[model samples]
Structures are given as C-alpha cells and as structure tokens.
Target: MESRELAYFVAVAEELHFGRAAERLGIAQPPLSRAIQRLERRLGVTLLDRANRRIVLTAAGEVLLSEGRKALTALRSAELRARRAGRADPRLVVVMKPGGDAGLLERVLARYAEHPDAMEVEVMICGIGEQEGLLRDGHADLAMLRIPHDDPTGFATEELLTEREVVVLRRDHPLAGRTSVRMADLAGENFPRWSEECPASGQVVRDTGQVAQMIALGQAIAVLPESVTLTLRRDLAVVPVIDGNLTTLLLAWSEESRSRPLAAFVRTAAEVAAQARPAEIGA
Candidate 1:
C-alpha cells in the first residue's frame, strides 16, 4: 500500500525472522511486526505463518515479495535513464541549399569535433525555401544562405563572407581557357543542368539568375559557388564572372540561439570560407 509497508514486507520475507528482519531494517521487532501487519491488512491477505519458535512465508507473501522487488528494480532503472537524458549534449541542426564543397563540409565537421560539448548534428540539405521553412518552424537551428530570409521578424542574419560566383563550363567551351569571364559573355549558351542526379547542378539552378538546364546545353553558362565548382567536376572549368563576381553568403538563425554554439560554428565557418576562396577561383 505504501513504500514503507512494501519495504517492511520484503525485509521480513528475506530474513524470515522478526528479530533479524527488524535488525536489518534498523527498527525494533514490535514496530517491524506492526508495519508488516498493516501491509497485509491493506492487501487483505495473510503473509506469514508464525509460531513462537519460527516464521515462514505463506503463498501470498512469496508472491508479493517477488513482484515488489521487481517494481523497485524498475523504479531505479527509470531514475537512471532520466538522469542520463538530463546530462546529454545539445544537438545542432544545420540547414543549407543542397550541394556543398567537400572541403568546406570537412572543415565544418572538423570545427564541431573540437568542441567539448558537441552533440550529434543533423545536416539537412534542401532548397533555400526549405531551409528558411525549417528555421522558421524550429526544425533547423542554423542555416547557410545566399540571401537570408526576410519574413521572420525575430530572425537575424550575419554576413559570413562575400565570395565570387564562378562560371562552370565544360573544359572545351571557348571561354573556359580565360582567367575570367563576365556574366554577359555567356548570354545564350546552354550550361549545366540540375537534377537529383547532379546536386552541384541543382545549387547552380537555385542560386543563379539564369536557367540551369539551358546552361548545360551550352546555350548559356551556369554560375555556381566557387567552392562547388572547385570540388565537383574536373572536366568543368570554373572562372570568375568579372562584374558578376560576388555573392554574399550568410549564417542565419533565430535571435534566441544566436549566442549559442550555433553562433560559434558560424564564426568557425567564416574562417574556412576565406581560406578556401582563393584556391577555388582563378587557378
């Protein structure tokens, strides 16, 4: 009926003698006997068979003893699990438009590795619209973006870096040999196409003003992250589009978590982006 009653029942059940059970429980024999009597009264069952010289369990006492021990064990296990959950690390979610440079991805992962309090991170690669939706809905803690969302009144964006957009053309294309090409030069060439099959191409579609598939057909040129072009296809030549040279990449989040580890990650990422910029564009 109560924890104390169950404890008294168990103590007497195990020791099988009133004097010894009371000693184990740190109580006098008469009080221990009274507690067990109270438990049997609540359960409406006889628990022990007692004579002047000896004590033994009735069938009912044996049954209650088995179940009470099991219940105590389960209670302890649940407490331990709850404590573990309380101490677990926080998870960081990163959302971005699909297609990332492999080296940049590696660098981001490395920075997270250095944090002592890091938890498991879930990386969600989606279109800009989806990334914005996740941040607004609380599904993502942070996002990397070409342009930060403007609708959410509580959100804030930090400009991480402004890096040049590059033209990715098949190696044999005429302007591919040039050190740089302006956006206007490739007005009608069908450039790289975006499909689930080509993630790098998909990002080119989402970020640039031009149609990506039309660019792939060589009637236009595709513009993409200098990082994407640098890491993806060896046969594609990436050249900065002179006047078209830059895109402002930002790290965005809700104002509440802006001071947390998510912000720390944003700072680390800016360093990686600046270091990776030069090797990615001209040579």
Candidate 2:
C-alpha cells in the first residue's frame, strides 16, 4: 500500500472519526474517507467497522495501524540518516542519559579513537527513557541504552556492561551511613517517579538532576544505576539496594545501519566494556 493511504488509514483509525482525521491531515473529509476505502479494497481487508454511528478498528485495522506507524518511522529515519551521511563532515551521533553510561563511555570513546575507521563521535545527552526515541527517529546513530536485550525494542544491540542499582537520598537521612539497604527499608521513602506512568505520590521528574534536586529538599529519594553516583552531589548519599534491578548497558544502533564507522565504534565499545571491571560501590 502507498504510504499516503497508510497514513490516511492510521489517522482515521486513531481519531476513530474521518472528519477529525481529515482536519488533522489538513484535507477534506470526503477525500480522506475515499482514501481509506481505497486502501481497504486494495488490501482486501475490512480495516474499520462503522456501527451505530461510531467507528471501531477491526483486528486487521489494529495490526495495520501498528505496522503503519513503524513503516512511517522507518521512512523518516532513513531520510534523516541519509541527510547526515551526505554532509561534508563525517560523524556519528550517540545518545545516552547523562551519567547513565556505566562509566564505560569515556573508556569506549578513548579506545575507539585509536581505531582506523573512527570518526567524530558526537554525544547527545538526554533524559532517561529518551535514548530509544532518539535512536528510532534517526536523531542519533548509536546509544548507550540500559536495556537487557540484544534486539528488544526494534534496535540491534550489543551487551556492554552490567551493574547493580542503588538508592540515593540526602546525606542527613537516618540510613545514609548504611552500606546497604533493602526494599523494606525504603518502604516509607518518597522516591521520585521518573515518568507519569509510575504509580508514585509525587509529580513526575524527567532526569537525575530533577531527582537530585528533590532529594536535597527531602521531597524524594531515588533508585538509580550505581554509575550515577559519580555525578551526584556531595550532599547526597548512596546505599546499595538489595532488591534493585540489574541495569545492563547496551550499545544500540539501527538494525539497518551498516556504516563502517558505526560498526567500529560498537566493536570498540564491546571490547572495552568486556575488559573493564565493574565499578565498586564505596561506603
């Protein structure tokens, strides 16, 4: 199917109303309706069900919507990646959460620079959970992502580092001196919720800086990757949380990317991460 038809179908499916979808698409309702009908006929599938004056997506419609979004994203990403490749200055863009690199970014870059295929590596520091989007949309060529899969979330990844997480709170907190704490000990603590989906008491915070600010004000405590401790303020204290999750650092890039510079960087990162010892948690 044409990308335009897929886009029309997606808009209609999401809005559940052709009129609204047409308005969103800056087109007339009649044309939008015809486009979707044409797409359905071409695909030989009933993509939408109109019953009792309301629109609902059929199973096939749902699948198309999901797949269509992916196709659109892929197209856009290809455009961006191609544009970057055509630039006079050859470079690679790598995205990551600030202070979330498991202490491997510096060492990785240093080692990768010695490689013959190395190019200028531009680091795009972002908030948590944002590296995925940057990579998906081709705003970045690589990322130091903290996910445990080799190919989860549609990106090809190589395992880089694995380390435990810890809780950070104000230094004046009663349990700050403890070398280790448990989930039970943090039961009553006001941990900052990094995203809106978290079922926590306080307003959502977007990054470590925000979490650190809240912790300093005694408004929040946070469980974070131990690598972040190096970036934390002196007033903040860390205690290893026994039940915290193990964050695995991965070198993530597009599955379709075959750039030699990108490949060399990934290989260099994997080698460095494999040889580097895990950072110790100090009391």
Candidate 3:
C-alpha cells in the first residue's frame, strides 16, 4: 500500500475520530473519510467499528496500526540517514534533558572522542519524557533517559549509571533538616508537576527550574535523582528518600539505527560507566 494511504489509516486509527484525524492531517473531512473507505474496500476487511458516538478499531485495524507505525519510523530513519550522509561532517545527535545525565555526560563525550572513527557529536537537550519521541521519530541518534520515568521499549539500551533518589524541599521545611526521609513522610506534600505538554506525571510546573523555585517558595516538593542536588539553589535542600525508586540512567538508540558512529559512542559510554566510582555509579 502507498505510504499516504497507510498514513491516513493510522491517523484515523489513533485518533478514533474521523474529524479530528482529518484536522491533524491538514485535510478536509470528506476526502479523509473516502480514503479510509477505499482502503477498507481494497483490503476486503472492516477496519473500524463506527457507532453513533464512538469508534473502535477492529482486529485487522489494530494490526495495521502497529505495523504502520514501525513502517513510518523506518522510512523517516532512512530519510534522516540519507540527509546526514550528504553532510560534510556527519554527526550523531545524542539527546537528553538538561542536568539529567547525573554528571557523567562529559566523561562519556571525552571517552567517545578517543575513538579513531568517532564523528562529531551534537547534544540535544530537551525536556523530560521527550527523549523517546525524539529517538523514535529520527530526530536523534541516541538518548540518555531515566528508566521508569522514560519507557525503554522498542529500542536497545545500556545502563550507564544508577543513583538513589532524594526529595527536594525548602530548607525551612519541617523535613528538610533530616539526612533522609521515607516516602510516607511526604505523603501529604504537594509535588511539582511538569508542564502540560510534557508527559511527566505530578503537580503542574513548567520545568525542573520552576519546580526548584516552587519548592523554595513552599509551593511544592519533589522527588528526583540525587544528581539534581548539584544544581539546586541554596534555599532548596535534598533529603535522600530511602523508599523511593532508584533512578537509572541509560544510553538508548533505535534498533533500526545502523550508524557506526552511534555504535562507537555507545561503546564509549559503556567504558566510561565501567570506570566510574562505585559510590557514584550505584549498585
């Protein structure tokens, strides 16, 4: 089937609303409706179950949607690789959130530079929960993401580091003086949430910086990786959360990526991780 037809079918399948899908595709409703109808007829299978106010995917539609996404991702990856090949200096883009690398980014980069076949590496700092999308959509070659906070499915990943989590609170807060705290101690506390556009869960805030500001102002508290303390303002305090989940940092790349530079960088990351201090690298 043509990519365009697959695109149209996938949109409708995901949105489950013809009008919304048409709007997303920047097309009129009538044509989008006709296209889906034609596709179903061509395949001799009913793809969607349309009711008065609801739409659901049929078994065949579900299969198509799953496979279609992979096909699109592969196509985009090919296009991006082709474009990069034409560049004078082919570089691999490694995406991560600002201050999310747990102090290992510099070491990883320096190690990668020692490789004979290493290409220039570009770091793309994005917000939390965005790294997977960037890698999946072909905008980045590799990413450093925290497990549990970020899903690691559909890609290959190597664990670089893991650290104990800490709760960030105002220095004047009642529990801030403690060396460590339990999750139960902060049960009633307000936690800062990331912005609406970000997929992160919690009380709504624009960014990590804002979360810190809010904590200092006594608006909320947050549980984060211990590395966050390195950049915390003086007004804020980090108290270890003995019961909180350990945040693991990982280097992830798409399974479809065949870039030698990306492989070299991954190998370097593993070496750097191996050489890190045991106390800093966690269990």
Candidate 4:
C-alpha cells in the first residue's frame, strides 16, 4: 500500500474516530472516509468493524496496525540514513531514560572517545517507553535501557548488566527499616503504574521524577532498578526487593544500523559493562 494510505489508516486506527483522525491528518472527513473505503475494497478485507456506530479494529486490522508502524518507521529510517550519508560530519545520538544506564554512560563515552574512529556523540534523555521509537526512527544511534529477560526486541543489542530490582518508598514507611522485603511483602501497598498493561498499581507515572514524587509523598511505592536510588530524594528510602524480577540493562541499536562509529561505540559499552557489575550479580 502507498505510504499516505498506510499513514491514514494508522491515524484512524489509533484514534478510533474518523473525525479525530481526519483532524489529526489535516484532511476533510469525507475524503478520509472514502480513502479508507477504497483501501478496504482494494485489500479485500474489512479492517475496521463498524458496528453500532462504534469503530473497532478487526483481527486483520490489528495485524496491519502493528506491521504498518514498523513499515513506516523503516521508511523514515531509510530517509534519515540516506541524508546522513551525504553529510560532511556525521554524529551519533544516544537515547536513554534518566539514570537508565546504571552509571555506565559517562564511562562508556569516555572509553569510546579513545577509540580511533570515535565521532561526536549526542545524548538524548527520554521518558519511559520512548527509546525504542527513537532508535527505530533513526533519531537515535543507540539506546541503553532495561528489559525483561524474556522480552523479545527486534533490535541488535548486547547484554550490559543484570541486577535485581529495589523498592522505593517514603523514608518513614513501616517497611523502610527492613533489611529486605519479598515481592509478596508489598501486598496491599500502593504501586505506581508504568503503563496501562501493568497490573495492581495506583497512579499512572509518566517519568522517573513523577514516580519518585509519588513515593516521597507516601502515595505509592515503586519497584525499580537499583540504580534509581542514586537520585532518590532525602524523604525517600530504598530497600532491596529480595524477590523482585531481574532487569537487564543492555545496549540496544537498530538492526538496520551498520555504521563504523556505531560499532565502535557498542564495543566500548560492552567492555565497560563487563567490569562494572555491582554487588548483586546472580541474574
């Protein structure tokens, strides 16, 4: 399908409202509707289920939405990479959440600079769940983030460090004095929701500081990477989450990325990660 048609479908699918999607795409509603109708006829499959005047994606639509996003991102990446190819001075952009690198970033950059092929590096501090998009869209040359052991990511990555999580709560909370606590020990305690799919959480948190504030106010407790304690407030206390899940802080980059500078940086990061595994090293 044409990029314009695919983009239109994606917009409509995300909004689930023709009017809002048209407004977002800067097009009239009638033409948008016709474009969708024509696309459905051409594809010979009903993408959206228009029942009871409500719009919902059909099974086929869901597959397209997932794959279409990748296609669009790949197309954008090609354009960006092509433009960078013609530039006189090419630089690398690294994206990560604040403190996501587990104190390895500064050292990594320092080591990479000593490499024979190192170039300019720009660091982009992003919010939760934005690193992958930035990398896929060619806005970032590399990323350092944590993921579940079983999580499947299509990016090219190298395992950096794996550590158990910790629990952050109000300094005066009852559990703050404990040496450690099991995941089950947190029962009935408020937790911040990192995403809509996460379960058994109270307030939705958009950033690290917001979650820290939630814990500082005694409104919520968060299970996070141990490195987060480095930035915790005076009113916040961190305790080892003895039985919490293991999170791996890894260096991630696009599968399509094949620059010499990118390779040098990734190798430097891996070398740095090897020597920096902290006290807890089971995972």
Candidate 5:
C-alpha cells in the first residue's frame, strides 16, 4: 500500500489506541480510524482486534507493522542518499556516544586520512542507544557501538575490540578497594539508569557523565566497559567486574551504504583495530 497508509498502520499498531495515535500524527481520531478501516478493506483482512476497552494487532497487522518499519527506513535512506549526492564535497558522518569508541577513534581517523580518496569525516556524539537509529535513518553513514548496549541488527558491522567490564563506585564505598568483584557483590547497590526508553534497574541518570557524577556523590554506581574508566574523575574507583558481560566494540554501517569513502573508512578501522593493543585501546 501507500507510505501514508503504512505510516497510519504503524502509528496505530504502536499506540494501540486511535485517539493517542491520531494525537501523535497531529490529526483527529475519526480520520485516523477511517484510514485504518480503508487499509483493512484494501487488504481484505482484519488488521486489528477491537473489543471493549482493548485493542491488539491481528496476525496480519503484526506482519505489516514489521515490514512497514523496514519500508519506511528504506525510503528515508533513499531520500538522504539522494540529497547527499548533490553536495559539492561528500563527507561520511560517523555517530557515536562521547568517548564510546574504545581508543580506536583517533587512530582510525588518522589512518583513513592517509588515503587519497578519503572524504571529510564528521563525528556526531549522540546519546546512549541512539547510534543505531542514526545509522538506520541515514543521519549517519557509520557508527561505533558496543554490544548489549547497542543492537546492530539490519546493519553490517566490523568488530573492533572487546574489553572487560568495570564497575565505577565512589572511593569510600565498601567495594571500591577490591581488585575485582562479581556482579552479585553489587546486586543491591544503586545502578544509575541511562535511558527511559530502555529502562535498567536502579536509580536513573541521563548519560555516563551523569552516572559518574552520581557515583562521585555516592548516589549510584555504574557497570561499563573498561574503556570508560579512562575518563572517570579521581574521586571514582573502578573495579573489574569479573563475571560481567564483556563489551564488544563494533563499527556499524547500513547495508545499503555503498559510498567509496565509507568503504575505505571501514577498512581503515579494521586495520587499526587489528594492530592496536587491548590495554592501550581501553586505556
């Protein structure tokens, strides 16, 4: 069907309420309801299961919701690529969280610069869990992401480095002096939550910097990749979390990206990762 129909279906499927979906789409409930009815009629299937005070997607609706999202992503990517093609000097936009690239970002940039055909590189530091969305929607040509923290599905990724996890705590905390600790040791401690969209247990904070501040004030602790320890303030103590999941760093790009500069940058990143020492990279 049309993009607008897909958009309407997606909105209603996600919200499960016509009034709420209409509000989100900046329209009134009746028109939104009509659009869904029209879509169902065209497809000759019941898309939604409607009952007293309840709404749920039918099997058909589920399929449309999944495929519609992919279609929208593809459409957006096409528009962005077309717009970028008209620019005088093409640049590859790389998105990542601040200080999230292990220690390979600078080395990768320097190595890529040596290539005569390399395009200008623009680094966009974004919030936690935002890298994937940026790359998917064509806001970025590439992104540096860590496993478990960022999902890399639907994109091609190159593994850069893997590092041990560390827990950042206040210097005066009971577990601060330990050489290493297990996850169970900090079970009851306050862990600062990063994003409301993906809620984690314990107290909530905006970003790692805020997590650090909270730790310094004895408000909360954080379990993060070892690389993050390099930026921690002196008042914080970092202890290895022996049983925590290892964080794997990856360079991710949309499967649709075919730019020569983008390909060159990916090659440089892999080469740099291969030669770099894990300790030096994490430090």
Candidate 6:
C-alpha cells in the first residue's frame, strides 16, 4: 500500500536472507522481519516460507514482486511527468548489461549536456532477460544488451558496435604472447563457463565466474567480450580471438519511447559510437 512497504518487500525478496536484507536496507534484522510480518498481515497472505537456514518466496510473494515492480515503475514515470511539466525538465531510464561501456555513455552525456531542457538519466545494471522486460513494463526507456534481439517489430534497435571475443589468460601463461588465439587451442583448458543465470551463459561461455577464476589462476582460458575483459582484471591479458565471432551490442527501445528523452539518448548514442570508433560494424 505504501511506497516504503513496497521497498521493504522488494529488498527482502531480492536478498531472501533476512539479515542481509536488513543490512542492505540499512536497518536491523528485527525491524525488517517485523515489517515483513506486517506486510503479510496487511495482504493476508504468506509471502515467504522460512526454514531453519533459508528463506524462499511463496507464490503470493512472487506475484507481489512482479506487480510491485510494475507499480514502482509507474510511480517513477508519474514523478518524471510532473517534473517535466513544472520545470521543462525530462528524464530517461536506461538499464545496461554489467561491465558494459561506461566510456560510451559518458560521451553521450557530455554531448547532450548543453541541451536547454533540464534532464536526468538514470542508469542501472541489469541482466539480458531483465532488459527487455524493463522496457516493456515501462521501468526503463532503453537498454544496452550483449546479444542481438531477434524481435524488433514494436521496437527500434541500433547496432552500436560489435565487440570481438578475446582470450583472457594470466600473464604467465604460455599463450599470452600470441597475437591471436583460437577456442580449439583451449579445448582442454578449463574455460570460464558462465552460470545459466548470467547474460553470457549458453552463448559462448561455460561458466562466467568459474571461468574467470580459472583464467585468474592460469588454469584455463576464458573468452569474453573485449569490453568486459578489458574492464575486469588488468593482470589478465586479453588477445583477440583469431577465429571467433564477435557479439553485437545494441541499443533497443519501444517505439513509444521515441517521443520522450529516450529519443535524445538514441541520437547521442549514435554520435558517440561514431566518435569512439569501437571495434567493427556490419551491414
């Protein structure tokens, strides 16, 4: 019913650990538990199933979590509309894949900073699955994703860049000095496979964290987006994949988002991509 209650529910649902949720919300565990209890009482439904050492959401909790996020998104849009009408200010929401190109976003912000209207751009790190959901549910105006989206009927997509896959290895590895590497060369190498929940999972990786750890330990080779590999551990050497294909990074949004600040962002991204000259582009 209240925004604070919704916030508490979301926090707990995300963490699933009472103490951790409390810590994340900047409160003690007792009050957090009490708040959950109150929320359950108010809704007349059990939201969580708690065991000795674990907590899991009930079906009711799952429904609430989904609807609550939609409600919160609508609230944000309402606030933005009010702000725009009163002060000629605009706001844009963008969800990005983790370890994405911050430099590119920075360029867009710098280029659009001189606009007459006051504007705010909110950026959040989200998974690939969440990106399209966020936009369709009105929580976000745009998203940057690792894989190319196949469906583009009601949405517009701009090919920002294609990032080469690179082999990440420890400096001590024998293959570190190679000008380029191949996946087969690391056949026996314990690749960093991404978890099924990870964005890169099932794409070209085995396990994301595990592979990263192996690469860090010089036990196996891991192939990752050049942008991501470069941004991660500097101790790891990243060499282009001589025969590997690249992942296409794209900017996508619904057509309805075109009239809002999202349009400005679309244009800014195009300009920034041209100026940055990231990797290669295809027709």
- Among these predictions, the greatest TM-score belongs to 2
Which regions of candidate 6 deviate over 4 angstroms?
Answer: 1-90, 127-129, 148-154, 195-214, 218-220, 279-283
Minimal lDDT window, size 10, model 1: 201-210
TM-scores for candidates 1 onward, in order:
0.53, 0.94, 0.89, 0.85, 0.90, 0.59
Q: Mind giving the per-residue lDDT tens digits that candidate 6 earns over 179-249?
A: 98777776666653344554432233422444566677766666767665435576778788888777777
C-alpha lDDT (0 to 100) for residue 179 of candidate 4: 93
> What is candidate 5's lDDT per residue for 9-73, written digit by digit as tens?
99999999998999999998998999999999999999999987789999999999999999998
lDDT of every predicted structure (CA atoms): 0.66, 0.85, 0.85, 0.85, 0.87, 0.70
Span of ten consecutive residues with least summed lDDT in model 5: 197-206
Q: CA lDDT of 18 in candidate 4?
A: 100
Candidate 6 has its poorest 10 consecutive residues by lDDT at 198-207
Candidate 2 similarity to native, TM-score: 0.94
State how far residue 158 of model 5 sits from its true place (Å).
0.2
The local distance difference test score of model 6 is 0.70
Alpha carbon lDDT at 236, candidate 1 = 57
Q: RMSD of candidate 2 to the true fold?
A: 2.2
C-alpha RMSD of each candidate structure in angstroms: 20.0, 2.2, 3.0, 3.4, 2.2, 7.9
User: Model 4 off-target regions past 4 Å?
Assistant: 15-20, 37-62, 84-88, 149-152, 279-283
Error of 1 at 226 (Å): 1.8
Clashing pairs in 4: none
What does candidate 2's lDDT look like per residue over 143-233, in tens digits?
A: 8777542234788889877888899989999989998998889887787776788887777876778888999999988888777776789
Return the top candidate by lDDT: 5
